[model samples]
Target: MKEAGATRTMKRAVNIRIESKQAEQTQTQQAKGELYEKNGAYYLRYAEPDGEMGQTTATVKWDETHIKVIRHGDVQSDLTFRSGVRTTGGFTLPQGRLEMEMYTHGIDRKLNEGLGSLAWSYDMYTGGAHVGRIRLRLMIEEDRSE
Candidate 1:
């Protein structure tokens, strides 16, 4: 895969799987999104279903050491992650929006031969109370049907 940028007219199909656990409750979600790379950063844009909370569009941006995730539409959030550093953002729920803190443990990224994977884990806190740890795995593959 090209590292700098994707072709302007090309859009690759990406598959995303996410598992989130809070307290004793766990949820798993899978979706298809569009993948594009620009200026050395890769982006994934997808829609998220929240049942009673409605739906939202999510955009994820990542480079070598940092990742930023944002959601819009029905819910909103902006979270950033980097290993060994704490980042702050906002999380929106049906009840309300709250400030959030995330401390990343590790991030592993690999992209080659039209396949890409990113793995990361982080600790989350809200209002000085520990929420839970989260692990995320993302995989992307080029759609070369053209």
Candidate 2:
């Protein structure tokens, strides 16, 4: 781990694949962004189109045990997922705000050395109602120019 303020920045091609059971849909989005590491945590910053949210900037921060996703722009949400733990948070959208709970099944953090991936699966709930199971996978592209 580097010092608290020391950060290593690299241009990384990021691929995000999301699978939702309730919607019965699978979507894949790709973007090039800056990947930073500091204080033993990884941060991936990217921009993508989010339907009603227009263009949204997504910042993914994760350590070994937990992953928190924050989206800013037209929509906003802060969700924390950890293994063997149930976390609650609220999602803000154009329509309104909704309280949600996430029960993470597992979080696998494999980003090390040069390149790897992070994968997690969890169940989402809102207002005591079961939503769906969601699986998210993020892969960090290697820099071949080096």
Candidate 3:
């Protein structure tokens, strides 16, 4: 992936796994993508598998204190997580609309130029009712096979 005016953009292999346990089922979404760095932050981009309309593009931007994820396609969403704080983001998706408040309680990350990893967890609520606990993990490695 390449971005205009970016300090650096490197081809990378990204493994992203998102797990959410609501009720009794644990749903997981995994994908491979690209990674790059700009200024002092890192941005990872990936394409969701082609659906009936085509593929959805998603980008994850993170730094030392916060993580923001944006997805665009048939549906659009922007979610944010701040270190050890409560952050709220809501958007409509193909599954439905999810507009809730989430409290992040866990955050662990190690990022650099060549490789990086981030793990975070939070509990979501809707109308004061416990929604579910969600965890997201990312593993990034620079692609040097070229």
Which candidate's TM-score is highest?
Answer: 1
Models sorted by TM-score, best on top: 1, 2, 3
- Per-residue lDDT value at 4 in model 1: 36
The Cα error of candidate 2 at residue 52, in Å, is: 3.7
Error of 1 at 94 (Å): 4.4
For all candidates in order, the CA lDDT equals 0.77, 0.74, 0.71
Model 2: per-residue lDDT, tens digit, 45-146?
778544655778888888767899998888888899999899988778888999999999998766564246778889999999998888887776754544
Model 3 lDDT, residue 14, Cα: 59
Candidate 1 wrong stretches, greater than 4 Å: 1-9, 21-26, 143-146
In candidate 1 the C-alpha lDDT for residue 90 amounts to 91
Candidate 2 Cα outliers beyond 4 Å, as residue runs: 1-24, 143-146
Query: For model 3, what is the error of residue 86's alpha carbon versus the real structure, in angstroms, after optimal superposition?
Result: 1.2
Error (Å) of candidate 3 at residue 79 is 0.8
In model 1, residue pairs whose N, Cα or C atoms come closer than 3 Å (at least 3 residues apart or on different chains), thus clashing, are none
Candidate 1: clashing residue pairs, number: 0
**Among all candidates shown, the one with the greatest lDDT:** 1
Model 3 is weakest, by summed lDDT over 10 consecutive residues, at 1-10
Better by lDDT, candidate 3 or 1: 1
